[model samples]
Target chain A: MTSSLVLGLELAYWQQSILRSLGILLAVLLPAGTFVYLFLFKMVSFMQSRLGPMEAGPFGSMQLLAEVGKWIQKEDIIPEKADRLLFKIAPYLVVSTVLLTYIVVPFGPDMIFANHDTGIFFALAVSSISTLGVLAAGWASANKFSLMGGLRAAGQLIAYELPLILAVVGVVIQAGTMNMSGIVAAQANGEIFGFDGIGSPYFITQFLGFVIFMIAVQAELAQTPFDMPIAESELVTGYLTEYSGIRFLLFFIGEFAAVGAFGAIAATLFMGGWAVPAAWADLNNNIFNLLGPLILMAKMTLVGGFIFFIRFTMPRFREDQLQKLAWTVLIPLSLVNILATTILKVAF
Target chain B: MSEFLRDYLTVAIFAAVAIGLLLVVLALGKLIRPVRPQADKYLTYESGVDAVGTAWDQTPVRYYVFALLFVLFDVEAVFIFPWAIQLETYGWFGAIEMSVFIVILALGLLYAWRKKVLQWL
Candidate 1:
């Protein structure tokens, strides 16, 4: 019996090491592929009233693959006057931020890579680094449009970032914890608006914050309705105007991946990551350990789809209009949300 | 490794690997892609105007005022977060203090508005 127990412990150790490696790999690579189709081709095409990528794989699933192939064959161009070093490194910097964010994402109750005490803050701080990368791309491109686009991105991101972080502060205050899993657990136990049966998701209690967070995230991602930074009509894809081939592809991947990352974070914060309702508590069995990510993905898809819906349906905001919304509207509303959440928490 | 270092190490590793993967994919693209740079193609695009003078000319962009304002409010926003995390512990005292803080900032915003600093010409 003792020998068998030792063998079991030995196996468990190896299994854990293997799982750690796999988790890191998935966190880094999966976001790049998971939503490429939904966000890139289908959603946009549907809004424009056409079949997207009908000729590629089954239901055009392979369309992205075909496009990647085509992009690879295209020439990598560098404008003669462009700053070569920054131009090359800018896209990578953005990618680095997106990847680092996954480390703290709580995929399940126990399925997080790192449940740092500063989880939400860590994600927010890392995401801000991408703005610097964007500014670098614009400065290095040596083009008027690129320069304008870069400055616009910097301003928009900085403005929207406030509301985004503040909105989460509501949820963070409610949960009374900064760790990602702790936030989820709080939601799982929470009741919505004092309703006994209704499971608490911050989406209901923090509705104002939710709306503001979603809007701010949309702007932060540079999607439609807030895409002044890359306004093709005015800026010709903005900071991306000078890039071609694989460099352009890097930016594309980073953007779509960011959409997924933000979706994941929002779902974790507002929708209650990996939490089933109390009524269905029995369903939260050992199987949840396996399906936890799937639950998170389902929530993420809903959040991301809402974002894409807004992106495709809404008109782009002008540069000044975008700044005004972030500063005058979102900032004030989020502050009010914090004040309200504080009073409510203190009273009840 | 300690849990703290391990967590951060994973983050660093994830970043390195992600950048590396992109580099490999781009490298693969470079291997098969053709490179033909013509003189015209090298010129910066300026709506087909044969690219006039350099693109570095200075123009009036009035948004910098708002940019400074953003810095002020953003710093204020940051201060609210830590206070928010410890809010319940501090109770009503914290609440009243934060209200006064926000009221002061709101006045700053009001001043800026009256001065028309927020107007995007």
Candidate 2:
């Protein structure tokens, strides 16, 4: 987990390639495996209020495969008179936008592609693009319910986006940099302009920023208490009503990937991103260095688990309630966070 | 190997991996749902009532006003962006050019507003 050893630059390109490929290969496999094991088998069974996947691979692991097979065997049906082009393109649009946000996410200090300065802003901008696709799918299906769902998604995306961007700006103002790495760096060494620990972990200086960031992100993900976009009972799975076969699958995968990405970003920005927890900080440098990325993963899982807990504990909010929460509560709170951060920046 | 071959090989590898991942994801998803075959199953469900023909039929005429207004403002803003970006360099000359353009746009909006055409159900 030491940043230097993590890259293994001393190794030949081919050796490095071998390790990189192996790492990504395993990275791809582990989560996908857990997704299949956890949600597909365990959760679905839990959903039915029954013991699940008990007979197959350990704890019904193979049941995910079986379920996948069943979804495949179903007919690929395009609704009669649906707008063929938009209907076909919408799922791709949604998934591609979600995947694009991954470019700046730091899995470890060395584990990112181009860190688009204003990485936070770049993400917020791109995340909003999915609403267009959802809108197209909803309107193209020509289904009233689907259109309403899509419209809801678009409105929710539009409204929450303001507060979400404002919240990120609050953090950016506190750190005085849009570069995520720089923001995290500002948090390091635990001192801000002679104020001990003010320049420390972002969550410390901009705790309000951190709080708003989490809320806005959860809303952006359309998670519990904020998932007005795809309220099934209200919108019949919303813009997704017309999709079948692979297209439908892409939407969910995009959704789950989004959940993971939000957790990663929150971990990176507010959770000290791979920084060893304080108790472990007292250990040897050699030990702490190796433990950082691992600790980051633990942090990510903790945030991810919070998402699952939220989903389980809350019910879908009424559409009006969702709007009111965003406009009244989240917006004012986010604005206050930004104002406070700005004042601190100027004062400092 | 030739450069052409290298280029083609790289493109092929990229395409293959991306396509492969997409296909596997979709394939796995398709394997998960229950498939029952019936005429009703094939039909679009509308609260158990038969869909009156297809679902993707025409919407009300009111949306046209919204669409037209969106296009008008969107184009106006779009045209202004280039001018706005270069406003400092162009100074008075650019400001005059933009004001004339906006005046013409304002007239159109005023005309539309007077006609009560902007309102939609």
Candidate 3:
């Protein structure tokens, strides 16, 4: 078996695989748990002027665990008319897609699970798979609300997906590579018109793309303002209307985990990713492999905070308004951004 | 296997591991959770009222139109990625070529907008 070095230890391929599997679990669940506790539990409560869950383990820190225990003991219900097979499989597909997206994100210099040439592209592609799961859950449930939620989610996801991809095109043009690590390296080594004090993170050069990407991400995650899919007031949690117990828990985890995954991707593309600026540290130092995950988590928290903040503050958009924003406003603007980026990239 | 294939293999393994973990939790839940097969419990939820018509009714045609537009732009996105990575090499020649491509797609979006197809209702 082939061997690879991790933390200065040589290990066999199988051992490395086991370690990586554990890492994937952490990468997905840790961020999900953190976001749920920090944003969903505490931040939202504070925003609403409440103390939040102070009873559960030191200021409601253990509320998530308590919620999980409550969910596990609840009955797993399948409606009589529901397609049992598809209903059972939907959450698996949704959660697994979120897990798969983390593979392409680089934590440290050598901390990536997969270093594909088309890393960011792979991440984008796998994320859209959740749309299928949403649609399936909607259709399989055989409920009017689920069906409406499913179709709305499908239309919304695909519409916002264009802007998301187009927004990344600007990043790809600036970084000159779709590889996530390569993009981070470019930012680390870059200078702002010969000023090397702070590397030229793409967020400055590609600010329009950054804005469009975040907006698209907001819609893609179906958070408020663009959350027509699961507009709880209207659609009764939308495609998730019929799910109960563990299945609902799976979807809940998938939603927050996706927020983390996309937040990490956004940080990688626009916020200089896992690297400190060249002025601060040498890019080649092996210490990054250790510090990188921590750096990424911090950045992810910033981006996730921004996402959830908007989610809490903003009112939901009407269906027509949501579609109009993606198709008319975001898409055309992203296309123009791409054109301008390409011109400047070639000119300078 | 080649290094390229090995990277993909890791992805496949990770996918399996995710599903496996979920399944383990699910099985444990099944062991603990109660399942009383009540008839009304299995009926679809409709805000505490009986469901009306079947949910398999036809949806609006606007959805299909949006799907078609998505396919068109998705292809454009695919084409743009390769050109993006190699833009430094392609220079103005590549820039002009991609410019023409993006303009055409934008025009299509404009056409959709003018036709009111972009509108949800």
In terms of lDDT, the best-performing candidate is 3
Better structure of 1 and 3 per TM-score: 3
Error of 3 at A286 (Å): 1.6
Using lDDT as the yardstick, the better of models 1 and 3 is 3
Residue lDDT tens for model 1, A239-291: 99989888898888788878888998999999988777555675347777677
Which one wins by DockQ: 2 or 3?
3
Off by more than 4 A, model 1: A1-34, A282-285
Ranking by TM-score: 3, 1, 2
lDDT of 1 at B110: 78
By DockQ rank, best first, the candidates go 3, 1, 2
What are the RMSDs of all candidates, in order?
3.5, 8.6, 1.5
lDDT of each: 0.82, 0.62, 0.92
CA deviation > 4 Å runs, candidate 2: A1-53, A192-199, A277-293, B1-20, B23-42, B53-121
What DockQ do the predictions score, one after another? 0.53, 0.11, 0.84
DockQ score for candidate 2: 0.11
Each candidate structure's count of clashing pairs: 0, 13, 0
Model 3 bad stretches (over 4 Å): A4-15
